[model samples]
Target: MTTTRLPLFPLNTVLFPGLVLPLNVFEPRYRALMADLLELPEDGPRPFGVVAIRDGHEVAPSAVGLPETGKPPELAAGSGFARDDPRRSFHEVGCVADASTIRERPDEEGYEVLATGTTRFRLVSVTAEGPYLTAEVEPLEEVAGEGAGALASGVLRAFRSYQKVLAGANERSLAPGQDLPDDPSVVSYLVAAATMLYTPDKQRLLQAKDTATRLAEELRILRQETAVIGKLPSVPGAEFTVRPTSLN
Candidate 1:
């Protein structure tokens, strides 16, 4: 696929396609970005990339190797740092999210916006355009059709089991099998993000290129979560509440 330039927001959390992320945007740059997005035509997919800043904070451009010209660092082909490297600046692959719903804070300080991931995009380069960072990116292709359904089903079942365990641990009830999308890619993303074990695990799932790979990774996480849950007391209390669905 031909690559295109996109505005980027480097965050601490990972976002997956089809998952909804609520962001508190307070910085002047992001406020401008949101304003520009609101002005764009909303007919097609209104998307932007969300990449996790690897080493330094996203709010500080100087930490991510912003050039003397005050431009965002370019992600060229020779860039050889691992995504998990603490020295690296950002993740190469990120999800494109549509800013579907937004509510501006009355104080005019920031906005509480709800964004839904629409597709995966790879960062080819990044440049500072005024306040926010922009990236050259390409859309990642979906998994092959032949095995998508099976992979998705496996992931859904695992997710169901995980949710059950979570509910049991917290003595809470969850409406299982509620309004899940039929698409395999979407299902994989939803399950992975919904059943969060750790940030790194979620990041791995988000970076997985295909449905099959993502399903396998999610199953592994579910098994690990189950094992950890098993070692704990069966008594229901706020202990299990430490890991809430809101974090996921």
Candidate 2:
């Protein structure tokens, strides 16, 4: 478990490794994050950590000057500047993402970044003394064991069945299957990214310490969702598009 200080991007949604996250770099702080990453050597990979915000605002809270229960006055009464320049509290686990494409926005406000999730990490500490969040992160890996292969196979089977339930693929329907990896770690993240599960559920899967646990959680979620849809037939989030960044 190697630790490094990397720029952090906190969002409202969870990101899984091996998934793609498209982001609009509109906010000032996040725009700063983009700039910082840009200054890194482009010869190799330039990446940042993205963690899900558990509370507070993605952008600064609207009523900024007011002091929270234990916060300092400069953040509240001391600063005449209205915007406290704060970041939200985020989940402990995050994914390191490498930018695949970057372009200037049409209006020229900020950049549009397409980041591909590379791996998961556990955020150790957040250094918010800068323009954007920077964090000390320890990289996380799948603790696969002898049983992980069996778990992966079961998860793959369950995921296919769940997809079929969602597609409503009747006897005549010749729909193809989603392309998923055979490796347990890759399979866990890929299916979690593809599924439209709730944010907490996704977070739970992300926080799972090993491939076996993550795969089991995915299977449980798949079965639960499939059962719900089977009875109700018109569940609200039956389908979802891959979400864009909440750059705020």
Candidate 3:
């Protein structure tokens, strides 16, 4: 796989492909990243890398203070102030997302946008020359000869179940006839990317390369959620705890 240099954003959350994540880009480094992206050529896919901050805060630097006493001496050389800075580094595995739609909010906090993930990439190296973080990335490809029909079918089934669960919980009617792609990879990508579950689960889906494996994982999650929903209370608006006598 060929490696490409991309702007990096280490966030507290993980983003999946086709998902709409609203981010507040008030931080100076990220603001610079967005500005740099806008300047890129319009024809090509302008991509960026997002990695979840595992140990430290993404907005600010770490609080380890100076070099530790018992730590490996070499670790201290590259490990103190740099660890605290958001722009200093990022995780290795990240997806390259296309900033499809962007709307600037009234204030300068940040722009709201929908990003679609196109490919999975691993961060090979990073350079901290400018305000934003930039890294060399290697794209991971899907397994060959994976049929689209089976994958799409599995994804569709899980998605339908997910929709049903959402409707049951929210007490809303299901939207009808949403068109899904026939290709398995596309289906898997879209469904996995658009889910509202926790970031770690989404990251797991993103990292799965084989179509069958991805579909299985998604199906498992769907079934678990469905089972959980079935066991929960059936009363609508029960979460609010309104008194029974107040309704009269």
Candidate 4:
């Protein structure tokens, strides 16, 4: 595999190939990252690696409290540098993303970025020598292993059941004429992204060895989730929650 260095953006969420990631870039370090990407040639893809934060907050605190002299305290809250060590702070597996649209905010304070996940990569090493994080990564290949197509068919049926359960529990109607893709790899990724699984489960799906393995896992997950949902009184409305990152 060819290894290359790419800028890293660690988030609290796991990204999968072909998923859309919209980021509100306001931090100075990340704003610099956007500026650097904008400087790249438009003809070339502006790619970066996005690894899930394994242990802490994605947005680090810039300061905690004022010192006795009324001066801003140094980064005391784990600081982004001290806490965000690549080897310890993030999952080794991640997805490479291509920035499709970048628009500067009218206030000129930040940027709104729309990026799409393109491929998977394994983080080899990381450094904070620069303003933002950068990593050496080896791209992971997507392979359709033996019996992928057959597994995909079963996964599709299981996914439909999963969706139905969610709709019933949430009192929402399913979209009419909805159909899933036939390609096993596409199905694997699509289901992985759509399912409301926790970050670790999503990471596990992203790290599956091949399409067949991913589909098999999805089949089991969908059935399990569907059964669990069926027993619940009612699925609560979605709301953001501060979940601790898991490294299992």
Question: Please, what is the whole-model Cα lDDT of each candidate in the order they appear?
Answer: 0.66, 0.69, 0.59, 0.75
- Error (Å) of candidate 3 at residue 147 is 6.0
Across residues 165-242, which tens digit of lDDT does each residue of candidate 3 receive?
556344322364677777677777677655555556766776776766777777777677656655557634333331
lDDT of 2 by residue, 1-248 (tens): 67999887776778888887888665566667787777777766879888887765454321122124432222321122213432326778989999777666686656788888898898887776777668899998768755778888987887777667666423221244436678988888877776666567788889897888888888887777667656654533444322222322
- Candidate rank order under TM-score: 4, 2, 1, 3
Candidate 1 runs further than 4 Å off: 42-44, 60-87, 168-174, 177-179, 235-248
What's the residue-level lDDT of 183 in candidate 2?
Answer: 92
Instruction: Pick the lDDT winner.
Output: 4
lDDT of 4 by residue, 159-211 (tens): 77777666633432235258767888988998888777779888999999998
User: What is candidate 3's CA lDDT for residue 119?
Assistant: 71
TM-score-wise, the better of 3 and 4 is: 4
**Pairs that clash in candidate 2:** none
lDDT of 1 by residue, 1-248 (tens): 69987777777677887777777765567766787787777665567788765655644331122224543343422133233332257877788989886667786655677888888888887766355667889888877445778777776776676666666444333367587777877787777666744555667777776777887776777777666765666634425533543221
Residue 226 in model 1: shift from native, Å? Answer: 1.4
Candidate 4: lDDT of 4?
99
TM-score for all predictions? 0.77, 0.78, 0.71, 0.84
Q: Which candidate's TM-score is highest? A: 4
Clashes of each: 1, 0, 2, 0
In model 3, what lDDT does residue 58 have? 43
